[model samples]
Target: MVGEDIDFTRLAVILCKPDAVERNLVDGVLERIAAAGVSVSARTDVVAEPWQVHVAYRDTLTDPGRAPADRPAYLEAAFVGRPVVVALAHGGPDIHARLRRLIGHTDPAQAVTGTIRGDLGSDSIAAATAERRLVRNLVHTSDDPAAARRDLATWFGAGRPAPVCDFENISVVLCKPDAVERGLADDVLERIAAAGATVTNRQQVTVQQWQINVHYWDLLVDADWFPGRDIPACLEAEYAGRQVVVALAHGAPGIHSRLRDLLGHFDPPHAAPGTIRGDLGTDSLTAASAEKRLVRNLVHTSDDPDSARRDFGTWYGARRSGLLAPLLPAQIAPADA
Candidate 1:
């Protein structure tokens, strides 16, 4: 259950439409949602099943006065081929309105200038109708509180509470091979605990090439990050066969930045004294380059909440039911206050 004082916190559902998925606009859409102060709770990439679409749009489909006979089929067709990202977002006060405003009007042309539909959407209702197709709006949000609850139940199941938003902040941290091999994992975890973050989950695994490749895909493309080298080969050499400690940490908001600060810079030599990298790591980028290897940075912390969720999903599947279940209110309450 949600905290009593914050009972007003609302939940909304967002569906990244198939066109957006095909265009690879999931990250940009998520960034806009986060910028609106909504925190993503749970997310999954799924191909919309016909039954699900009918269930989701039942009212619209059944209202003969509103929808044309072919509307349901057209809608289903639009959603079937590509994977749509269905996400639950939570926020304090008027969350439904905030998400609706962010998503904009049903028609791109009539939508306000600053909204997501206005900015990213290209198709108009008129154009779509003329072509006998569904409107290519980039995303969808529930119309009201009732609709939000209904859609959430339909999409994410009836009783499951959204995960990440249950905590003030959730972050994923990795004690990379260097730290694990050097037996510095405990020291790094101690520093995190000392900073007031709780370790909700911990697991040690020898990373796979595919997982590492997906995890660091963005970094692989950045020339500065992997200068003058084959990024995949380098990553394989450093991480693929090595064991790393992947930890999920929870704490107050801004925990990601806090942990990153504790972990210090990527290059140990450039890290400030007293930080984990500064204290435990000694390898330099220059030395690594000379040796044709990666700098032995001791730890990795997510850059922000979005990055944290994405990394967590990549490392651990999105449906994190038992993996690091959050503490119940009774468990955290003082015994004899």
Candidate 2:
């Protein structure tokens, strides 16, 4: 059944992840919100600086009963973790309350089943079960209308200016050889734009199996199966040293999740139908041979600036001669050719 209609003053959700947000799950939330006929007033992707985290969790810091040593570690853990913020403004009564209900609470146990956290979260340390809730939880919504109002003020300027622009940060997109070979580059880019992300730097790359083996080196060395699932095929000759595309997309709210969802997992066939995988994937599960089966997913989405820099170094830094010139020196810039 449809629920109460709430006009949000403005709300910001903190979405944290290991690397990238999952496709079908996050897309479902966006689709549900859109189906409800709500329009987003503003959106941005925020990487919580140390001070910001300290401020957000200020109340937790001084709980007198808590150990001082533990408090610092807790603060550090939450601060450095990769997070994305999705902020919005609405024009109806009880909007703040409604959004609070729509998205679940930060604590895993308290999150409502129908919300993003309930459905997608697993253990912050590990994905024990598809249904397991994490200490990280899937997402965070403001606690109450008052807190929502206050948070909007801090994170998004409380609607002083429009909310959906690209000034806050940037995106790094990896359009693998599969996309270029299948002629779906433009379609993928269009989906990214439709989702509100801007493309800042785009390039083509020719990568070797050994390079992928190195980039995913941790996976290669792991004796466990889950971590090693994609390594072997990544080494196959048919997939060796192929040309791929790379893009640095400017960050905005909604765009990051949208692009990853649209790109699907590394191998397209496993991706859901509405996604890029369903639309363009050539290798299906039933393929007769390894060459016939598509590798993991099509695109790569960076979790944060640090990850972007690290992965870009493994993939693009070794390839690009002078790209990303304006990036700050201390900002963990990607290595250059």
Candidate 3:
């Protein structure tokens, strides 16, 4: 029942199958979901354990007490050893139904064109049956609202105890256009996870001039922050028209600083090796200045709590409430009180 508080919104789960991930279709699948007006509230890449897969498809994996005995085993095998992206998507009251339709039928050949499976998938049940394998559909969505709730909990621990945070910090990390264009979004996300944070909300969007202005208002106007740097020119030269992957990550105290460290220095040449920018970025401030462009650092992170809150507001208004609201501490005492 964790996700059943409909009240004009519903929660759904989408699993980008291993084949989809291998084919690098995660971004396309997410884009389609967002095109349908669904927002991703939480996401994680999982190399699922057998038990997790069993829990995810409990009905199918159970002894059917009928024919087609090999179906369940084939399905289970398909899920094992492959990395899948598990995402929690929220939308209007009919979100569950919408996602099912968006993802398409279980058998790729039977799915209608334009749906994810029909567009990206090439395998069929008939061919799979002939090959004695499970249909290699590109994605999976909950069959119903009930299943959505169950799968969310199963994958994201909805009802489980919250992880303790020293300051209950939340920060925003943006994978800049260059990173996405280079197919480094997954690598960046993996590094974020490696740094001990959880991505609670994510969206892929083209950067707007106004949002960039607001995001860098201080650096643009306040010489104290940039020490005589020209704000407007910097903004126009770098972020004016670019695609960016925005994500909200939560962790213990100092999460903002932790993310900043992981992102490396603003200047790629000066960034220490092993950090995101140092590892992936090649542009230098001198070179960029000569070209009248901004350094091609691969990411952006909030510098502090205030900036985190501000950036979250600018990128995701009410949608932020879905993940942030539940994390707030309760004020009421227990009945024993």
Candidate 4:
């Protein structure tokens, strides 16, 4: 199940609570995946918006004459104070085995010790919420292909590998100080161009914990792994003072990988020397398992057409973005304008 034989099953590696609390736990699972030699196709950090959760779980509350309106307060209580991190990845070929091994590392009854949840967790929800604290649980993977496709589209986009000539993608990149410090941005851009990717927008925005949480919104359920404790305070602290670089590139299928390969993870220390990270990265944190260290292991791509359109709309404000735009748009625009 290696290479192209296996379908590119998209997995949403969700992180909820302990912006830092669960860092080690989640990092370990990712390390295990890397150990299996499974390459991570794409990754991103998104904070879960309460509204999005409300919609995703709307069905649960609206069953059999249940009114969703009645659940607003509950939604507010559950999400008002907390935010979650979402790590997105595409996996295939022995990933399940690797993931199972990681899960098995935790304390079975009490968070499955040795796993992300067990080692990092404490009073559960008490730390996250004064009334409650939660332990850090690492990663969330999408189950099955259909769910994978759906989840990928919801988070990454339509998963298209080709370019929409009329529209360009807004590639959001973070050139951590390490990249700039090492002066690798030029080479990174050159690589992106070589891979058929073009930059349409770019920015050097500092990352706030809340932004990370909002970006990774698909996580953050008050479930078994997350005891729904002191989440707000943790988020407040993580987001208070942080800086990150952002870029928006548009072009073709392999652009995201190009940048990822160049940036390495977090800084210059950890990246492969010839590659972008190799030349500029400066972190000891191993690459997310199988892949080499490059960037913070946090570059994102639109998983599908729908997702691309939605994300583009959010980032670049394309008025008519979607698969059905051809039919829905009042007038057809030139495909390659």
> TM-score of each candidate?
0.52, 0.39, 0.64, 0.37
Positional deviation of 141 in candidate 3, in angstroms? 3.4
lDDT of 2 by residue, 214-247 (tens): 5556655772544423446645543567877766
Model 2 score (lDDT): 0.52
Point out the worst 10-residue segment of candidate 2 by lDDT. 1-10
- lDDT, candidate 1, 174-290, per-residue tens: 889988998988788888988888764466768988778878888677847566777777889999989998777878898888888888888888899988888889799999888
Off by over 4 Å in 2: 1-168, 223-233, 236-239, 253-256, 265-270, 285-296, 318-322, 325-337
**Cα RMSD, each candidate:** 15.7, 19.2, 6.8, 20.2
Candidate 4, residues 1-337, lDDT tens digits: the string is: 1111224342323333334323434455555544444333233444556655554445546775744454556545554445444343434444444455554432233666655445544444334444432223344454445544444444443333323333233345444444544556556656655666644233344555545455434434432333433444433443335544444555455544555555454444655666655654444444422232222432344444444445445433354222212111112223343
CA error at residue 225 for candidate 4, angstroms: 62
10 residues in a row with least lDDT, candidate 4: 323-332
lDDT for predicted candidate 3 compared with the true structure: 0.74
Using TM-score as the yardstick, the better of models 3 and 4 is 3
The deviation in Å at residue 253 for candidate 2 is 5.7
